[model samples]
Target: MASELIPNAFLASPRSVRSSLVSRLLAAALLTIGAIAPALAGELLPLADKAVVLAFGDSLTSGIGGSGENYPQRLATLIGHEVINAGVPGETTAQGRERLSTVLRDSRPGLLILCLGVNDFLRGVPEAQIAANLGAMLDLAADASVPVLLLAVPAPGASQIDPLFARLARLGQVRIDLHAMADTLMQPALKAGLVHPNAEGYRQIAKAVAQSLRDGGALISR
Candidate 1:
């Protein structure tokens, strides 16, 4: 019985050693990925002075309630690039997804600023549909080799930030957290209406976006 137990222990030791080695390798790989992810996530193509950035969204992008100074226009001024406002008032994510290809064809922009889904949130659209529509739009941009900057729009009265947009940002390799600027602009003093920002608010948003682009290494020196 003692001899049989000794062989069993010997047999088990190799397996245990192999398992530990595999675990160590996996941990090292995970650490490597963790260290590199931030830089990779923030990487972007260098923009030319005249590069076009397509600001595609709904009413907020259209300067509704703004002092004739929408975020796109403000961003154009801040970045010194051509930011084409492709926003349509009262548009939903599904509508934007459907219309995006045509706009891409027409604009041929180097970058895309996606800020839709507010109308969908207002209309009680499901989060899944919203994500799916946005994903399709990202896929379209990917096909065109256009880098995207994702702006998260929160639902009214929500207690916590939505995770879907951040998840999509990682998957799409685009900038996230632009929603924080939107939230800042949503303050009563800055907001012209319940949903849209005023001129000063738009300027602030543009500044935040420009800084984000610069930090992400996306903006080229003019």
Candidate 2:
């Protein structure tokens, strides 16, 4: 027998079972309202169908120093789904991991866009600890079968964290080179600053990530 997909209704009231069922049916009917047309197993799922896009990181992910466009918010428009911005400014890898349980329990995101490490580097935290915290979060996501897109902080004018980004790649993990993307933002035309990007820069990063997923055929069905 095909395994029965457990309904979330058990969390609702017994007296409301009929109403709950009706509501789900209505929701199914209204699903098209968001223009997020559901993708079936036979069809490739669009970015919109991806369960959740969790933006977990520091200020950059929080849109700090930027005007109004954060990468995660822009990524949502590009990908078409609910983007949960869990970024807290001034957060370090340890703090992020400490808060990971709340985010995981709340969203159960399908994709975790991790943008940490800058604070750790700034505070002169040991690189090994940084790596361990990150690896632990990645493991958490892995345990839940959620894919990750790790974005390392860009090397400052003279300092580069390319080694960290490369490590993620070497591990056969999904990682995006936002450092390079940030480099693009540093261009005279797209210049923002050493820390955050402008709207155009966020768009560039989002487009790059979206294209990466498209190219890799990483969009998965829920």
Which candidate should be chosen as best, given TM-score against the real structure?
1
What root-mean-square deviation over C-alphas does model 2 reach?
14.9
C-alpha lDDT of all candidate models, in order? 0.68, 0.58
| Model 1 residue 17 lDDT score | 38
Q: Which ten residues in a row are the worst by lDDT in model 1?
A: 1-10
Candidate 2, TM-score vs. the true structure?
0.69
Q: What is the TM-score of each candidate against the true structure?
A: 0.78, 0.69
lDDT of 2 by residue, 1-222 (tens): 000011122222243333323233223333232321111111112344647878888877777655788777887777677788888988988899888877887898766777787777778886556666776676566556556666656544534343544454323244454443545445545546666666777777677666544543445431
Instruction: Compute the lDDT of residue 141 as modeled in candidate 1.
Output: 77
In the predicted model 2, the residue pairs found to clash are none
Global local distance difference test of model 2: 0.58
Q: What is the lDDT of residue 115 in candidate 1?
A: 87
Candidate 1, residues 8-82: lDDT per residue as tens digits?
121223333323322333233333232212213335567876789998998878888776888888888788899
Top of the candidates by lDDT:
1
